[model samples]
Target: MYGWADSTAIEVLCHTEQCVVCGDLADGFHYGVRSCRGCNAFFRRAVTFGMQFSCRRGGRCPVDKNARCACRACRLAKCFAVGMDKKAVQPKREGTNGNGIQSQDNSFDQNDSELENRRTSPYFDSVQLTSPESTYSINHSIYAQLTDYTPLRSPSPPPECPFLLRLCYEFSEVKRRRKCMLCKSLEEILTEDCSIRDPATAEDFTVVFQTQMILMFEWVEKLPEFKMIHDPLDKTKLLRAFALRYMLLDNVYHTYELGYNDRLVFVNNNYIIPGQPSSNFNSCEVVNEMEICALMFGAPMQTLVSELVSIIHGRNITIGEIMTVRRLMLWNPGSIGLSSNAQAIASQASNNAMKELQQYLEQEGIEQSEQRLEFLLLYIPALTKHTKTMYEIVRLIPSFGKMSEWNSFMDDVLRGV
Candidate 1:
């Protein structure tokens, strides 16, 4: 429903002198794809300004060198469609050259330098949407005033940052809407009031896994930070890390919340029982748990569900904190295997999210805020221990045996993570 009929297709590189996003003059590679300075500037300004453009003519605008300005939304969409990475558009540095890149890849060097000088100065962390008829300029005093913090905060804190507020809500909504995704399915009647008495069937696990994976992508793609990561491999790697943690954390928390003992609940309300034979966890057929997991563990894999649920239930974790953990787990900029641009963008995004969490806590005036922060952030690594076990179990599933053989979007995710 957007600009070109095939919005997801990555346009092939045309002649060296042609731009991939629009058939304009080429200006080398920008964000891993070849493009022109004109398109580069437009993309940069759009991202840097956080511009949200809409297509009035149903979004199927023709964006070419001759009419790049015809539809801002389509042009921007085409940029991403042709691989113009938003992560490549670095955060607007208050002062030039303060931002750091985590990876040694120099592909970002030129773009970073150029973007540094062109970005809006962070006169104040908050930006206002001015009337389209008027111009907005940086107010140095506002920046100084905003930074002047005291040990004591105002009795009434300001409004929650819009992005953070929206993020918190979106995270919360996922839990509520996860059910009914596949309306009228066999597991549709499963609910919180009951425990999954039988071991989960192979097909039960696969259907839930597929649904989770789909939801994961949906959630990840909406993130502004993840949007910036233009490299497909880097995106996959970051998602891979988030996926295991997401699957494990989301289910464990849901299980604990519903007071379900030692049984993990799926998004669609199907629950996986504890102490089932590993053979019962099959993805190859509708059979109950496959034996491949047992061969790896040399045991029933009882610890998988029981131990996971224990961590959440014992802690009495809250949904607010789980929401934070979900976003924070996207990518650790320091994690190995990320490209330079990906690492830099991830670092900024994760750091911003961390800061936003603190701000949110303070704004809400939550009790023992510092401790609340510590418990969840630290729990990230502790929760990671189960991922190794998870990867071992899921990777052994016959359907997932060869990643390249699968046609689903999860192919890259399963391999990269």
Candidate 2:
């Protein structure tokens, strides 16, 4: 009897395949399962709309061609049982027929002559918006494609002496002017009388920077490469290098988010306007010190801030791009004192993050992705330049160094010891 049943199954397989759910003659495979056109369309619609169905009787209704329409809930359950894969379903293509009704093409054509052409075309891939999982799969595929491009290597060491000095000097001058402008704008804030003698207190700047550092630390913890670094010391070192730039970048983002006009940056509800006298010191002493600091280091910091804010606002940088840039900054392979092995790991991680970012940009349908990538690369140098300037300023200011000692993380960042 088993042999007879096997023979009957073979015979049935030899004939035109029937829909596993509806028992109607199958029209090839739809979403990885053989089903008739009607069933295929119904399944597509159900999945697309996230349609739920109720079976009148415990969902045991027999689903066949004639009775399939009687209980959609049972039919859908049977579709899944028969190995219908919703992930395999291609996104619906919209087109208009002569009648002007919007028609959806749900077919997944594996053997189309245009497949290779489409794959090679420089166009963004269409993603399924109906499901998060499907969107992720599509994004993963896009990232895989981006990974096919050359991997990024560690950047070359900085040029020695005069060249580096010249670059830093030019950058410094630009930064100085921008900082002066920022400070002058905030001078008005100081002119207004508050209860406190210091309009822009050191306590306020410290509070803001420290609070931002906490947020930055949390952000760094989320990156894959940072998490992979098992050594606490290494993590601390990386975080130390990352924190300042992260704070500056985040400030740029915040400045833009608050509207371009609202340039006053408040940290922990404390505003740190350049040139504002601190309540902790005599008015003359605070003014002279702030002026000296602003004249020396303010421009470079302000220049970096202005450039970053302008770029982000002008280009409408997405959160995804910002996240990717953060990863790049955090995993900086060129950071001084990293071992060869650490550099190698960082290079690979940075490349992977870049590829992911490329996919994100493509999905956003942003034009000139290649150009955008190059622009992002430029930010690395800007970050390095600004960081060097910040280091110099911190070294010069004994009080800032003392304040940094209050927070262990900030202390580690300041001393680098």
Candidate 3:
């Protein structure tokens, strides 16, 4: 009887120590509340940014770890009601630009020196491509030049077959030349001084994911094919669907590079091992919101990525391979509400690219070249599965969902779903 009573007391003590906001194990007192880092960060950002939120459910929404993300308004309200001090939040430090004046803008600028450094770096020029067949060389060059050619502002009619092929080629080149971070080898990434560790808090994840999404939008805008989609609605829908799949593919590629056979991969090459506390929680016995989210979503995703890695294991995926797959993904024919003409154009482009890719692989003497071609085709379904999971997770987060209202690109993507 005494043993039972002691156990009950311990259980209550543990429960009391849990974060009041998300019910995750608390990481000690933060901003005057016993909360996990995710909640603590969330509250801090809400206060610091003067972020406004509206509840989809009229403010009565449950604010547990599982449902806390459902309503930002309620979540923030609960934070205040639970004694999280708004005044405890500190101002973000201002960063200086090249001239050393404090810059007010916190948003990442493409023209920043960091990006310029990468563009001029000798490492980017080190990748040596063997001279392709004359046909491939001519097509590749044409596509590469398309980055400099601006699309017509007026909505033009669908391009001709030859033009479609050129557009596909151009897309492949643009993606290749952009030096996608995902395309970098694990060794290269690890050696680079800019590698950011995995985000520990919900706010950090939100910022990193949102930044990646923005970069993806910029990448899409550079595609001649995307600009050809005249209808604003169609463009939005296509971009949204494409963005989701793009993010998934990027993550899968990164996971492959890292050789994370069974671990969960996040943006910026950070990963989480299964059944273990993530790097952020090493100091406390607490389980963070991200760790919980990963556990719930990571297993199936890891399995899917592992299967993909196994298929292409030991072989270095070439620039042509990556380009062809990217081109095929961009022109998704099955996206909801895609027009027949667009579908036809996309299908033709993908088929043409596939033929070109097959020829290149065969010329390179890859064993089972035909099988390797088919493997690229297999990425579509796997990417779709991962994208759907991500979309569901994003929808649950009110802040991300709210993005649709403020960000046109995000709106198009979310609304297209």
Candidate 4:
């Protein structure tokens, strides 16, 4: 007998703590209850199904000491009165680590300790956003912002920062000016210089920063062994979008080195088209292996990718159109220019999408539209990566130049990789 009266029915006897909702002596049954059966039942219902009821009159509802259970709303308040810990409610599972795994102690505190280590980690410390504002407490904001994805957060930082940082930010205006430029070209730069300090309202800029964090957590969630393995080399690369940030800026710097002395390439002024130049196929686009390595260091693996897909499909996307609009405007500067290459790609994508939609025009084929959109989105990037135009345009940019002096530079980045 753990101090309960109705032995067969299991009614816990009340000590000094009475049910806050009902004056009846409470038993320790429902959610650390000290209330009556009605209140206990209410709490159990609230916890089990997540009912959100509001008092029509106001917030304060009465609770009687004897014949209690006045208002449904009052019962919930009583729950808080007795101290049901909200923090104790575990966060829902988001995704797995890079290795597709999880552990028993999935507490926020434990995750914070891990992030703190990566922050202080020598290789990553420089880029770890130590600006006190970036340091967060264990709360809803942190979880809402970062930890849900673990894989990308697991790796050490790239070693080529301070210099790389200086190089990328030098031509921030180009991103603003190059509205009609080839999208693949612009996207390449975005990916190359993804690690540059986030720009004000820049689409790719925000995506790079956000992706870095999301991928980091996703990386951890995917790989269970990442917790046990201290070796930094085992991590997958960051998303190409993020890696391109540094790579793109590096290419711009190389452009100056290559004597492509057109200031229009890097400045805020637009380059006028003389005529549609014939696409060249044989050019070698500079890769900036160092930045790519850094990008690789921060990439999310399979688990995170799956989670992101789930997040997008889980909600009614139509309601979030406004958010999508903002993201597109930020990332695809070409959205403002009808003639921009991004718009062209978008148009091409739309056409393909229309073909996918045609399948559902006659019947209950709506499900195929979702699948079609998904496959197209994934496939588009892969297809775009292989274009001759992309290769030519990327080569014209400077960062693609051969890094004769990369041995030392690479050594630095590899120290953390």
Predicted structure with the largest lDDT when compared to the true one = 1
Task: Give one digit per residue, the lDDT tens place, for model 3 in 64-137.
Answer: 66555555555555565444666687666578899998886543322332432342323211222332221211
Query: Which regions of candidate 3 fall more than 4 Å away from where they truly are?
Result: 1-196, 199-205, 277-298, 308-311, 333-335, 399-412
**Decreasing lDDT order of the candidates:** 1, 3, 2, 4
TM-score each candidate. 0.53, 0.46, 0.48, 0.19
Candidate 1 differs from the real structure by a C-alpha RMSD in angstroms, to one decimal, of 17.0
Q: Can you tell me which runs of candidate 1 are displaced by over 4 Å?
A: 1-161, 185-198, 277-290, 293-302, 305-307, 314-316, 399-408
Q: Which candidate number maximizes TM-score?
A: 1
- Write one digit per residue (lDDT tens) for candidate 4, span 304-346: 2222222334333321121122222223322222334334544
lDDT of each: 0.55, 0.51, 0.51, 0.31
Model 2 steric clash pairs: 22-65, 175-299, 175-300, 176-299, 176-300, 198-279
* Cα lDDT for residue 271, candidate 2: 36
Question: Worst ten-residue run, lDDT, model 2?
Answer: 180-189
Write candidate 2's Cα lDDT for 1-417 as tens digits.
121222222122223345555656665657755567777776666566555554445434556665666655555555654446776755567898799998765343333323222322212222233442333222222223222321112223356522222222333222222221122121221122222122444444454454455345434544556666664445555665776777656655556555552233442223334343245444434544564356332565456545555556667666656666777887883546675666776888888878877776776698899988888889767766766665554444445433533433355465652
Over the full model, what C-alpha lDDT does candidate 3 score relative to the true structure?
Answer: 0.51
Candidate 1 local distance difference test against the native = 0.55
- Across 144-163, the per-residue lDDT of candidate 1 in tens digits comes to 22123210112332355456
lDDT score at residue 224, model 1, on the 0-100 scale: 91
Clashes of 4: 56
